[model samples]
Target: MSATDDVDRSSWLSGYSDTVEALPIELQRNFTLIRQLDDSAQELMDDVASKSLCLMNQKTVLSPKERQQRLANIGSLLNEVLKRGEEKFALAKSTYDTVDRHCTKLDMDLQKYEDEQLIGPTMGRPSTGTSTAGSDKRPEKEEHKRKKRKQTRGRKKGIAPEVDEGQQQGEYLSAEDAKQHAQSAISLSNLPIDPNEPLYCYCQQVSFGEMVACDNDECEIEWFHLECVGLRTPPKGKWYCKNCAELLKIKQKK
Candidate 1:
């Protein structure tokens, strides 16, 4: 047993077979560097789980700094919905150019009312009447010879032709003497001392019966039945009319 302990036990078994012959290569190279660091840590955990499931199926969920503040609030709501749709298409093209300039000024006012009703010389008259200007017709005898030379120069200037209601019925008065001469000229304008019987004159009874006169402009004033001025009932305190209470007492004595 002692040859030096059999040469130290064959040199320790030849240095343990040379350390088991370098372990496999070192264990493949450390297991290929730990399988390339586990495929880079599973590709950085699949890029952080696909950006956290794209911020949890988004609609608006965000967090990576709130998805950059929800992408800057969706780019300011698409620039305020494209500036309110370009201001409603420029106000619908300025209301279609103001309704095409009011339909070209109503087609030039309907062609000037059809050229003033076809230059009318009694245009198309037939209202069931006699009129050929009263008819002996040579253009109604030249329009009664130019209306008898303008009514003989308006009766040589005294101008009496406007006599309508059977010639102004003797100038005026006669609606029961113009309501008794407008109640004798509103009781001779002594203003309202009339305890119920004043004011006198206001006529116009059929054909030309007029007479009107009151504030003494030479006496003819008369016409009373506007229910005799209590104006058909309301009276209690503020009564008025007697020529507006004598012009409001001459405007409160001036």
Candidate 2:
């Protein structure tokens, strides 16, 4: 909600490779073609049925030569229907093959980008279904490793942590602190009772859903719920806690 990566979601999507955007549109066109083929085939079958009924009628007297000509017309119509169906089937197969190739490349590209993000100075921040590349969802573990800061027993006071110098957005965050935040970034829903504490965010609810971590090293309350700050979707890049965002704005205006 409040905290967002430097690059906005729209901007990131716009800059993606051509295939990423085009493949969806292309797939839709293919589906439409398939539907059209179905309708056309049904209409042709109705035409054949109507002609067959006419030939079967005994009330009308027909010369041998005329009867033979009617039979020929029916045979040609049936052949036409078969030809049309075969052509449509071939086109559909080709369309699916193209889609398969595009997806395979997209998978490789996303995997490489995700691997790169895990290294270097920004290492150890757990992503919560948010990234500019829009990679595949990270696999959910049946059980997440439980690691929490020591805290006193009770319903959390629902108090905001003290704002230190490091609480500023995109400011100093020690590597060790980043690692700690990443390790503790489990789904709030799965956070066990007693040892774990939830002292930050305006809602001040215990781990109940997906969470994102502020990069700030000294942030007393480092983790925040994605929903608490009004974010329907995760931020495109690095997300800071609400306090850090406000602090950053004040500093900017100054």
Candidate 3:
């Protein structure tokens, strides 16, 4: 087997070896000697059994002196094996007691570490203190501000703020300029004007009808007949042509 295979095989016994090493020097030596004695005793027993088997297979009857000598050798080997077995048992018991003690100590240390580092701080609740003067007044100030906002919200809609007049006049002037430009462009075209049709009326392309002008002053197209745009009656409020409505939406977005 490779060195890696040897290491892997020994890993299961690593804990046992570590426990033994932690023992006192005298106990360590005693355990080692016990293991050596056990191995030696096993070898001697195996040798004696093998020799007896060979003798029986050969059908060779032993002389009386040889028989006695063989008996003596077997008896000595048996006594040695028994002695070594007892010593090994004693050493094993001692080693087990030492390992169990070490394991117990380790468990207690782990529990102590967990209490001091993980549980102690979390279990002790922090003390509460009085709020500062500034903090104590903050809520009252916020309540007053909220009351002022509610009072403003209760005002009548008729008292709303007025729009700037200069902005309105500028819009009116721009609308008039756009209308003049559209008229000039139409005049430059060579197409003959139909006197029967209203200018800027989409309904003229489809059918003749009484047309209404868009309320938006900036719109170049002036009139629309409701029938052509799928409306049964004139719309409520200020009405706008499709082109002027699109332009108004763009301005509002800006």
Q: Candidate 1, residues 1-254: lDDT per residue as tens digits?
A: 34985687588557745654664555565556555555555554565556556656778644688787755555555555455455554544444444444445455655654444333434466743454443334465566765574455434433333432321212323467546645754554432222323333232221112211122222233233332332322222222336644765797999
Error of 1 at 183 (Å): 67
Best by TM-score: 2
Best model per lDDT: 2
Q: lDDT tens digits, residues 33-114, model 3? A: 7879789888978977986776567567889898788778777877887887888877776665665566665566556654
Instruction: Report the CA-based lDDT of candidate 3 relative to the real structure.
Output: 0.55
- Prediction 2 global C-alpha lDDT: 0.58
Q: Which ten residues in a row have the lowest lDDT in candidate 2?
A: 146-155
Clashes of 2: 2
Candidate 2 per-residue lDDT, tens place, 1-254, comes to 11354355346556666657787788788778878877887788898899989889857799999999988988888887897788787767778578666666666666665565533323454764454233432332111211223121111423233343443222334666555544455444343333333365554556544455565555557666654554444444456676887787898999
Per-model tally of clashing residue pairs: 15, 2, 0
List runs of model 2 lying over 4 Å from the truth. Answer: 1-17, 117-254
Please give the distance, in angstroms, between residue 223's alpha carbon in candidate 1 and its true position after superposition: 52
